[model samples]
Target: MSISGINNYNYQNYYAGARHNMAKTGGEIRGVLSSTSSASSNITLHMSDVGNSGNALTAMGFPDGTSASVFQADDYNPADPEYRVRYWDKEGNYTDTMVKVNDIDPQNASYLEMLAYTSYSDVEGLTKNAFGDFMNAARGVNGNISYDADNIKEKKDYMSMVKELMQLQYDSNNLPGYLSYKELYDYMNDKING
Candidate 1:
């Protein structure tokens, strides 16, 4: 029941350091929604507030008529530390999206724009390494243990692919105004693997 690229030990260290940084910079509240409600509650709250003030769509930098929907999986755990969103546009229809709960300073306006610009899965689903895992499992290979080198390489490769795709998006004038291409790349890498 473990997921790669998410180390609780490393995350604890990161959180401690991030908290310290936030303290030094003055603790700023972070989160897309103004209400400090639960994620499930937020879903209902948002669904009811379309085109109104303080709705989730507007909070996410979308226009008045935009919408966001949640697909609550049976095993969904809002408390999971590794949780992140995967979103994409469905042509002229509403943006297909999921939700994540993490504190981010609302004052940092670029945060929403960054989220919007990178409106795709953080990890490209069904990667070669992932398929290999399935193949191994099918062959009765134990999934409990994995080589550190392969894990590290997979992480690097995934990040590299994401960076290249993001760069291409940016080159096409898709990046937000607040970040240069380099800044966006570094920021995403740090967020994913810091």
Candidate 2:
């Protein structure tokens, strides 16, 4: 059945519109309790309970009795895979509406952990050429360079490169206008040492 302006059940198409609406309005299509406080002024919504309670259907305007028929089987088991409802507010502030599903239930945790692990794995694969170049430039002869005692060789190599860059900077009139490398290095070292 279709709501007046909304289309009939078409999972793939429905989510796009739902996401768009939630993003534009800073409104939620679903939410779960995160925690509860004994203080009368604050009440937390346990998202899992909300999910298990099948409140999303009611918010979507499904009749109370039909919630199970609409969302779950006769046994009242969840049909959807684990997921948390989240969106950014109108002012671009991020709001996490629910704890990730995996964090809620140990049984449900694998998928989210796997997703996180995969994302970090991808980040690890990213080449650091830009960062390496920036580090190299920073160490130039005009740059104060120092290293911890643990990796003397690596530090020496880095400082050697920095010295070359500093020489180049000295030869050219374009050294950065900030404090000299020695002064900046001394201040930073003092702060760290203290």
Candidate 2 at 123: error in angstroms? 23
Count steric clashes of candidate 1.
1
TM-scores of all models?
Answer: 0.23, 0.18
Query: For model 1, how does the per-residue alpha-carbon lDDT over 22-67 read when each residue is reduced to its tens digit?
Result: 6654686564233333432322213222332222222221222232
Clashing pairs in 1: 30-104
Instruction: Report the error of model 1 at residue 73, Å.
Output: 17
All predictions: root-mean-square deviation over Cα?
19.5, 24.5
Candidate 1 overall lDDT versus native: 0.32
lDDT, candidate 2, 38-122, per-residue tens:
3223222222223443432111111111110112212332332232332222233322232221233211222222222122222
Worst 10 residues of 2 by lDDT: 60-69
